[model samples]
Target: MTAPSEPTDASAPSPGSPNGPGTLAWRNAVFAVFFISGLGLASWVARIPAVRDSLRLDTALVGVLIFGLSAGSVLGLVVAVRLLARFGAPRAMTISVATSSIGLVVVGAGATLLESAPVVFAGLAAVGLGMGSLDVMMNVEGAAAERAIRKTLMPLMHACFSLGTVVGALLGAAASALSVSVFWHLTAIAVLVFLIAVVAVRSIPELENTAETSAPGEPASTWRSRLRASLSVWADPGVLLIGAIVLGMTFAEGSANDWIALASVDGHGFSNTAGAIVFGVFVAAMTVGRVIGGPVIDRFGRVPVLRACAVIGVLGLLLFILAPNDFALYAGTVLWGVGASLGFPVGMSAAADDTRNSAARVSAVAMIGYFAFLVGPPVLGLLGQNWGILNALYLIVALMALAGLAAPAARERHRR
Candidate 1:
C-alpha cells in the first residue's frame, strides 16, 4: 500500500531494506504468489487423464496438444522482454495470472462443453503463454524479496512452489475421485488462483523501477533504448553462462518430471506402483532440498553449493541410468532431486543481483531454463525410442557437468 521508501521502522532488522518498511509482508505475499502458481500448474496437469477421456483423444493427439503449451510458453518469454519494460513486475505478474486463469477456464470449457481439440489446444497455449511470463515475473519478484531480506530466500520460496504443486495434485485427485467435472473443477481453481495473485501483487513494491532503468543507476530512453537494453541481455556472456547452468539443471528436473516413472518401470523393472513411488521419492527429495537450501547457501555460498549439487546430480543420474539394484535406483532418484533443487532459483537470484538489470537478465535465464523444461523431454523421448530411456538420460548427465562448469557464473555479481 505504501510506495517504496526508506524504512522508518527503527526496529527493522536491516538498514535501507529494499522492500521499504514492509519487507516481511512483501516476502510472505511473494510466497503466496509462488504457492498459488504451483497450484494452477498442477491443477491442469492432474486432470490430463480426465481431459483426454472427455475430449476422446489418443495419447498421440494429447502429445501434439501439449506442444501448444510448450510453444506458447517459449513465445510468451519473448513477449516478456517488452512487457517487463512496459508494465513492470507487479502489473505484469497480475496480467499473467489473469491470463492463466482465463486460459484454464477456456480449457475447461473446451474439454467439457465444446469437445474441440483445436479449442483445447488454443486454451493450453494461452495457459502456457500466461504462465511463462508469470514464471519470469514471479522469479524476478522472488529475487527482489530475497534482496530485501538480505539472505537466501529464493530456495525456500521455490519450496513453496513445490508445496503448492503437491497440494494442487492432491486436491485434483480428490476432485477426480469425487467425479467432479473438468469444467467446474478447473474453473473453480482458476478463480481461486486469480484472486490469490491479485491479492499478492498488492504487497510488491517494484513498480516500474526496473523498467526505465538500464542497470543500477543507469537510465534508458523511452522506447527503442529500452528494447535494445532488454534484448542485449541475451548477448551478455555472464547471463548466458548463468542460463547454461539453469538449462542443464532444468533439463534434469524436467526429465524427472516427465520420465522418472516410466524409466523406473521399464528400465528398472519396477511395477507400476513402485515406479510411481520412485517418482514420489524424487519429489520428496526435491522439496526437502529446497526447504533446507537457504541456510546451506548462506553458510557456504552459491558457487560451492551449486558445484556440489551438480556432482550429486550427475552421480544420482548415473545411478538411475545404470542402477543394478533397487537400492541404487531409489538412491539415484532422491539424489537427482536434491541435485536439481537450487539451480533455477539461485540463478534467478544471481541474475537479479544488480537490480537495474534484473528483469532482463532474469527473463533471459528463465527462458533458457524453461526452454529446457519444454523442449528437453521430447528430445529425450525421441532418443528413448531407439536408445532406451536410461541411455537418453545420459545426455542430461553430461549437461549437468556443463552446468557445474558454469556454476561460478552465478556467484555474486560485482557491484560497480
Candidate 2:
C-alpha cells in the first residue's frame, strides 16, 4: 500500500487537540443518529393509540400502514450502490441526514395533517427511504473511519447506536409525558440531528478511491458500472453466506424491535407500560453487548463470536417461548439483546474482510440482511394473526440457528 497520506488535519484524532472532545463526542453522536433515527419509527409507536383514536382507524387497517419504513429501506438498499458511487461519502452522508431530517418533519407533520391511511403510508415511506440511504452510508463511512484511526471501531460505533436507541426511547417517553405533539417533538429532534450531521460531516473521509486501473480521468461508476460491481460482490460465495447469516440475525432483531411489545401484551398479558419495559430491557442489553464487542472481536475470531451470539439468541428466544411470567419475559428479552448485539457489526466486518471490493461487498450483504428485516416482521405478523404471537417466535429461534451454523463457512471463505 502507498505510504499513508500526510496526516491531514481533517482526518486526525488528537488527544490534546481542541477539537478532540467535539470529534470524540460526535463519533458517539453519529452512532446515536443511526440508532435514534432507526427507532424513530418507534417514537410514534407509543403514540399510536393517540393517532388511532384521532384518525379513527381500526387495528387491522393500522397494521398495513406500518410498512412504510421497511419498504423505503429495501428500495434504498437496492439502489445504494449507485447512490454511494455517485455522491461519494461526504455528499452522500449530507443527503441522507437531510432527507431523514425531512422524514422526521413529515412524520411529525403526518400526525396533524394526514388523517387518511394512504397519506400516513406516504409519510412512513419517506422516513424509510431516508433511513435506508443513511444506514448504508454510515456503515460505509464507519468502516473507513475505523481503518483511518487504525483500530477496531465498528463495534463501539454500533454500541453508540444502541445507546442512541436508549436515549430515543427515553425521549419518546418524556415527549409523551409532556403531551408534546409528535410533530413538534420530532421536528425539534430533527433539527438537532441535522446539526449533528453538519458537525460530523468534516470528520467523514472520502471513499478510498477503489477504482482499478483508472484510464486517464475515468469517472465514477454510472448505473451500468455500479450494477456490474454489485453483481460481482453478490456472486462471491462467502459474501452470499454472510448475507444469509445477517439475514437471520436482522430478522430476529427486527422481530424484537417491531413485535416484542405486542407479544408481551397480546401473548404474555403484560400491561402496555410493562410490555414497553420488556422491550427496553432487550435494547439495553444489546447496548451493553455492543459496548464490549470490540475487545471480543479482537481477541477471538469472528466466527466464534458470531456462533456464540447465535446460540445465546436461540436460548433467549426459547426462554421467552417457554417462560411462564413477567420475570421470565424480562430475562428473556435481556438475553436476546445480549445475544443479538454483535451480528450486524461483526457481520459487516467479516464481509469487509472477505472482499477487497469493500463498498460493493458491504452494500451487497447489507441488502439481503435488510431485506430480511423488511419481510420478516410482516410474515411474523401474519403468523401471529393466524396462530398467535407465541408460535411466531419459533421462526426467530430457527433463524438464529442458521446464523450460528453459517459462521464457520463464512470465515473460511474469507481465509486467505
Candidate 3:
C-alpha cells in the first residue's frame, strides 16, 4: 500500500492508509530502525579512542580518517534518490543498512586486527555511505508514518536515536573499562545492527505513486533525474528556510557534541572528569527535550514551540558562554539541549508536509543540515584556536537567532 494521498482524520488513520491495521507495529518498526541507526553510529564513535591507539595514529591522521566518513556521506546523499528509484523503499533500506553494518565490521577488523589506517578509512567510508543513504530513507519512512496517523512523532523517533547513542556510548565505556578490544566491541554492534536491519526492512511500506518522483504511465526515473529534482529543491523558499533551521539547530547540537567537554575543561577550569560530566548533562538534556518535544509541539503547535526552543537554546548558550556561576552553567546546559532538540526533526517533518515531493525535499534539507558535521568542526576548531572555545560558540547564538526568525517556515503547510 502507498502512503496517504491526503491527510487522514485526526482520530485515526483511515483503513486505506499505509498504516492500515499494522500501524502500531509499523511505528514501532520505524522506532527500532532509528534506534539501531543511532546505536550503530555511536558504537563506532565510542571506540574511536581505541582505534586511534591500536593504529598508533595522531590527531591529524584521525582528522583525515574522519574526513573520509564525511566525504562518503556526501556521496551517499548524492545517490539516495537514485537508490530509491532503483530498489523502491524496502529494498533500498535493506541495502543501506547492510552497507553500513558491513562497513562497521570492516572498521573494527581494520582497527584492531589489521592495524591498518587505509583499511579503516575504507571501512569508515562504507559506514558513512550506508548510513547517509539510510538516514534519508528512514526519515522519509518516518515522515510518512507520522503524517498518516496525524501525530508529531519525529521528535520521539529522534529521541530513540538519542537513547541509542546513550546505550552505545555506555556499552563502549563498559567495554573499555573491561578491556574489550575495538574488534570485539564494534563487531558485536555490527552483527546486531545487521539483524535489526533484516527485521526492520520487512515493515516499511512501499511507495507506488507517493513521493511524486515517479508518475504513472512513465518509465522508471533515472538517478540523473532524481539528482536534478533534489538539486531543484534548493530553490524553494520554504524548504530553504527549513534548511536554515536545520543548519542552525544541527550546528548547535553538533557543537556541543564536539566541544562541550573541552570547553568545560579549558574554558571553565574544570577537571577532565567534571568536563565529561558537563557534556553528559548536555546530552541528557537533549534526550529529555526530544522525548518530550512531540507532546509539547502537539500542545503548542510547531511555530510557537520552535520559536520558544530557539529562544531557550540561545539563552542557555549565553549562560554557558558568559554566566558567572555554577547554577547558570547547569541551567544553560539543560536549556541548550532542550532547545536544540527539535530543530532537525521538526524541519524534516515540515519538509515532508507536502508529500508529493517528500523524498526530494527531505534529501535536500538533510544534505543542508548535514553540512554542519562537515564544516562546523573545522571552522570552530580554527576559531577556537585563536579566540578560545567558549568564545567560538557565540557563532551558534547568531545561527540560533536565524532559526528563530525562520520558525514560521516550519509552520505546517497543508498538502497541496
Candidate 4:
C-alpha cells in the first residue's frame, strides 16, 4: 500500500491512493484494536471505586488520587507531536501503545497485591500519560489516513472505541462480580492490547511532510517560532471555533463516561452491577452513534447535526437529573450517549477540514478541549461531595448547552 506524505496536511493531495473498498477491511481491523485498547482503559477507571474500597480509601482521597491520570495525559499531550515527528506515526503509536499496556498491567498488578494508594496512583498516572500520547498520535494517523482515502473515517474508528468501552465495562463488571482480582483482569487486558498493537503496527502508514514550502535559504522555524506557530494555528478564527465545539463535545462525553456509573449507584440506588450497566448502555449508544455518525454528518453537514446533538444532550441530562426511578435513569443515559457520540468525531473532522496544519491544528483543538475532561469530572466529584449527585447533574446540563452554543460559531468559521 502507498504511504501518505510526511507531515500530512489535510488540504494536500495524498501521495498514496485513496482507501478503496479493497483496503477498508484492513483499516477496520486497525480501528478495532485501537478502539478496544481505549475501551479497556475506560473500563479500568470504572472499577476504581472497587479498588479504592479494597484499599480502604475514602471518596475525597480517591478524587485526589484519580486526578493523577489526567495530569499525566496532559503532560504527554505537550510532548506528543515532537515524539511523533521524530519517530513517524507507526513507531510512535506502537511505542505509546506499549507504554500504555505497561501502565495497565501495573495498575492491575498493584490492585491484585493491594498496593498502597501512593503506588497505585503513580501507576495510574503513568497509564494516563501513555494513553494521552497514544491518543494524539493515533488521531494524527487517522486524519492522515482519512485524507489519503478521501473520505470520512474517524467516526467509525472512534465508534469502535465506544464499542470497546462497552465491552470492557461488561468484562470488568463480570470480573468484579466474580470477586476476581483487578490486577489479574488488567494483566489479561494488557496481553490482549500488546497483541493488538503488534498486529496493527504493520498497517500504520508513515505520513509525509506537506507543511508550507520554505525558500532554500529560509531559516527553519526556531523553537520560539514553532511554539508560536502551534499557538497561532489555534488562534485562527476557524480553529478557535472548532476548539469550542470540541470542548463542548468533550464535556458531554467526559461527564457521561466518568460519572454515569457513580450516578447510577449513588444517586439512583442501583446495585453495582446495575450501575456498571448504566455506563455500558451509555457507551453502547455512543458506539452505535459513532458507527453511523460519518454518513449522517456527510449528508447533513456538521452544523445542523451538532445543534441537534446538543439539544438532545440537554434533554437527556435533565431527564437523568429529574428521573425518580431506574427506568428513567436508563432512558436518560441512552439519550446522553446518543447525543454525545457525534461531538468528538465531528469536531475533530471540522478542525481537520478548516486548517492547513492538520496535525497541529487537530492537536491544538484537542489540547484545549480535553482540559474540560480533565477538569470537569474532578470538579463534579467535588461538587457531588459538597452538594449532591442531583445538583451535579445540573452542571452537566449547563456544559452540554454551552457546547451546543458553540456549534454555530464552528460553522461560521467554515464559511469564512
The TM-score that candidate 2 achieves is: 0.80
| Regions of model 1 farther than 4 Å from truth | 1-23, 47-63, 78-94, 108-116, 143-152, 173-185, 202-212, 221-239, 259-281, 321-330, 349-363, 384-391, 411-416
What's the TM for model 3?
0.77
lDDT of each: 0.75, 0.66, 0.75, 0.70
- Backbone clash pairs for candidate 4 read 5-207, 5-208, 6-207, 6-208, 6-209, 7-208, 7-209, 19-149, 108-183
Cα lDDT of model 4 by residue, 1-416, tens digit: 00111234234334445655434544654585557556657668667757766777655556666677778777767666677767876677677777777878778767668567776778778777777777766655665666667676766667677767888888878877887787888888877877787777676656554223221222564566556656778558767777777777787787777677777777778766677778888888888887887778768777898999989888888888889877887888888888888877666666666434654566677776778767876787788888886688787777678778878765635455
Query: With candidate 4 superimposed using the best TM-score fit, by how many Å does residue 90's alpha carbon deviate from the native?
Result: 3.5
Residue runs of model 2 more than 4 Å from their true location after superposition: 1-42, 45-63, 78-92, 112-114, 177-181, 202-229, 232-236, 356-360, 412-416
User: Which stretches of candidate 4 lie above 4 Å from their native place?
Assistant: 1-7, 10-26, 205-222, 233-239, 356-361, 412-416
Model 2 over residues 310-402: C-alpha lDDT tens digits? 988998998887788768777888889888887876677666663346556666777777777777756876777777878888998998899
lDDT of 3 by residue, 1-416 (tens): 00111121222232245546666667777898888887887677666656766887654466567666777777776677678768887788788888988898899899989999999999989988987777766766776778667777766777777877667666766776677888888889988988987887776667653333442222465878767766878889999999899899988987776567557766788654455456657777878888888778778889999899999999999999986977888889889988998898788778878765666777678777888766775577667767877898999999999999999999975422
Candidate 3 least-lDDT 10 residues: 1-10
lDDT of 1 by residue, 312-347 (tens): 999999998888889989899989999998887778
Q: How many backbone clashes can be found in candidate 4? A: 9
Looking at candidate 4, the ten consecutive residues that score lowest on lDDT are 1-10
**Whole-model lDDT for model 1 versus the true structure?**
0.75
Error of 1 at 112 (Å): 5.8
Please estimate how well model 3 matches the true structure, expressed as its whole-model Cα lDDT.
0.75
Best by TM-score: 4
Give the TM-score ranking, best first. Answer: 4, 2, 3, 1
**Each model's TM-score?**
0.76, 0.80, 0.77, 0.87
Better of 1 and 4 by lDDT: 1
Better of 2 and 3 by lDDT: 3
Give candidate 4's whole-model lDDT: 0.70
